[model samples]
Target: MKISPKARMNRLFTNGGCLDVAIDHGVCNEPSFMVGLEDMPRVVDSLIRAKPDAIQMAYGQADLLQSRPEKDKPALVMRLDMGNPYNATRHRTMWSMLQNADEPIIGALEMDAACVVVNLFMLPDEPEMFRQCVENISRVRADCHRYGMPLMIEPLVMLSNEIRGGYQVDGDADKIVTLVRLAAEMGADIIKADPTANPEDFHRVVEAARVPVLVRGGGKEDLKTVLMKSAALMAHGAKGMVYGRNIYQHANPGAVVRALMSMIHDGADGEAAWQVYNRG
Candidate 1:
């Protein structure tokens, strides 16, 4: 009905690349001392000062984003799932709350959402589960196409007690490359992926997928570490970054956002970005 996804893609990228700030964690984890996303308006305001390309968040926060006085604001990316970290430890997976919500998608489109987002989990040696993941996206794909919205699928690697935290870092490039290929072929307009831990290996992930690949923020590492890792990922052909805590939870959220955008969009190294952050 609308050619919004294309425009949203453009809204989320500039001459350099995309630096999308993700604040949708509240849907799953809720507002804890750690997340600090319960007040959507305040958090959105904090990130807006940093001037990101887009802000991906749950549809519930749409009104707060639209109310901003600055018309030249970042686009909205509507998250369509929810999961809790406390519960995540139980399942050892992030998408424990994955669901197909028709109402939210409709509301998001009405709010001028740039795109609709979903997450899928695929473990190694689980053909049945893999099929299930595909089937879910297959359904969403049809709806997004009909509405002329873009679908971004995050095909996560198998989660287990393998990583230090209860997160999905498969530590296997082969699996990531395979997953990226799977998501792309399965009809993802954009793919947000866990880094294969190395640029060369992640580059294969970018190369394997037909859609553009953006690196995830992963754990709550320090800004310097995140920026350094982001630079490497971008060098390896990553289109951009979709980070949450790394951008907002910092002491100065605006400075952190600026630093990340400078690194991502202007080719500034981590240290250079850090210096800019320190100055502001």
Candidate 2:
């Protein structure tokens, strides 16, 4: 029996939204991103217990989550690309490239993944990098249609600045909206995008993408801030969130995930979500 793409995509949502935990930072090659992920098994197990709608992971580590014998495991979103823009410690030319182009969709099928993610980056003075990202998405989109798999496009606007000592997420609304719309136009089944600098402007991103837009949790922030921002984004039409460090780097990852779930599914405001986080 084969599952349809619509069915696989439906599994990634609950009550009209989703909360996807992202542990795919290992491929970024940034040691700072590895803080809570030192033990793969423990991290994966803890996340499973947290029970997010899905878990986004790179090819190598995805097995740790999907191999579980339990019938209620989180759906997997396999990352099909790797990039150097996340390397913050040293100065280097930034690049985002696919790990494998030819058989990525077939490989995801073999892994029983529900969806695949690839990057569509907008970087300053890096037209070539942007072109490469567009090409990768085009190739992946064809395979996704062929295999009946959902494709999630992560469109980011990044800048190399001394303040962050490397490429950092840029929240410029115009840039983000343009790239997000482009990603959707290019055939993204789902769009994972960063919130604009002004929370009110995020609706434009959602409108432009014309798809289920999931907010990207960039760097780690204080609990209250994260909850408040999430609430604001959701209020402005975001479908949900795809959080990385904000969940995994917390003192209690599971607690944070549950709190976020309350916001995504239960219409919990920031204060209510904060109480949920504290209870954990």
Candidate 3:
């Protein structure tokens, strides 16, 4: 156990306000990642000004980040495991494609990251694969904990055709709770999962989970809709938000991120957050 759970939680909490930009898709799926890289400098500059509590990047990007001064940077978390977008398979299996424990540990040591995140999601045709992923992440979490590094586990519910590119698993609250429980039991220090579209149901998952919960953002929608949902999650006791294209792919990512920060860390209402974006 950590010497002080309260201190540890405080260090990890970001005051119940966090903005985690998911730039890990490059290594996991997107081959034209240089396109993402093209926009990264601007996106990162915007996010830093927005003052997110943390920013997530692929292990590969850590090298680039290392060259920058730490004074102006958001806290970092390196992603350890990944799968291809073309695979068309939910990440349920343990394959050599995923990073080994030593890799992230070494990266954490080198990058001076605040934590590491791994995923564990269930697929319709792969119960056995899910089991293997669970076991694999469990071992990784234990190793992370032993070294006093925080580990966040994301449990996805697999989406439907309506939102073809959705990265989050699209399931109900009860189902999400089960996945969160499994990850926490596996020794994850923090759990990131989907927020129920309904606030009441989303709160229920927050109450039941053993670890801190940061809602993962997916589902393509307008910027206002995204900000509203993210606000709702925070109001219902989510520790924070981890989102990708929702921020990076926006027409005005800087403004969008500023709006998100108002709701998250500044306690602004959705309307107030919108105002901030419009002002920008």
Candidate 4:
């Protein structure tokens, strides 16, 4: 029995919002990302206990989470591409589709994924890289429609300079809004975008996307700051967040996830969420 994309999408959200934990960073081949993830099985087990709305992972690691026998588990979101923009030492701009790029939908279905995620990057002075990203989205979009699989597009504006030792997120409002709109135009069912530099300016991104926008948690931040930003982004019309380092690298990953869930789903303010984080 095949499931409709709408049905699968519904599983990825609760109360009209989602709190997706991204454990797909290892695919970027960055050693720093492997700090907490050294024990993949343990990480997956802890995350399953945390019970986020969805778990985004690469195809190879999808089984670690999805293979569990738990009746209630996070929906799987398979990442369908890899890129080298995250290499901190050398700033090389390259993006490539995964092994199953040609038939990504089939691979995702085989893994029982509810959604598929791909990148649509806008980098400075990299026209060819930008072109590759666009073509990747176009190809994935067509297959998504054919197979009724939800597609989540991560549209990022990056500066490739050695800012803070690695490629930095360009939070310029105008640039983010432009690429976000383009992602929606290219048929993204859901858009995961970086928040603008100004929290208030994030509303413009939400408006331009014209689709469900999930704010991306770029880097790790302190507990209070992460909670406050989550509340602010939700107030700015964001549907939810797709967080990685902030959740996975914390002293207690499950605690942070629950705190975020409270803010996103229960309308808990920053202070209240902080209490939850400290409780764990």
Most lDDT-accurate candidate? 2
Enumerate residue pairs that collide in model 3.
92-129, 157-169, 158-169
The total of clashing pairs for model 1 equals: 1
lDDT of 4 at 126: 76
**Model 1, 47-102: lDDT tens per residue?**
77667888987766777887777988888888876543323344433333444445
Positional deviation of residue 5's Cα in model 3 after best superposition, in angstroms:
7.8
Query: After superposing candidate 3, which stretches have Cα over 4 Å from the reference?
Result: 1-12, 31-39, 85-97, 101-104, 160-168
- lDDT of each prediction vs. the true structure? 0.74, 0.88, 0.69, 0.87
Preferred candidate (TM-score higher): 1 or 3: 1
- Clashes per candidate (backbone, < 3 Å): 1, 0, 3, 0
TM-score of each: 0.88, 0.96, 0.86, 0.96
Residue-wise C-alpha lDDT for candidate 3, range 168-207, written one tens digit per residue: 4565777788788777778777778887757667777776
Query: After superposing candidate 2, which stretches have Cα over 4 Å from the reference?
Result: 1-4, 89-92
In model 2, how large is the Cα lDDT of residue 160? 61
Error of 4 at 273 (Å): 0.9
lDDT of 2 by residue, 83-127 (tens): 877765544566777788677677688889888999887876778
Instruction: Please report how far candidate 4 places residue 67 from its true position, in Å.
Output: 1.3
Residue 235 local lDDT, model 2: 98
Q: Sorted by lDDT, highest first, which candidate order results? A: 2, 4, 1, 3
Q: Which 10 successive residues of model 1 have the least lDDT summed? A: 85-94
Looking at model 3, residue 128 earns an lDDT score of 60
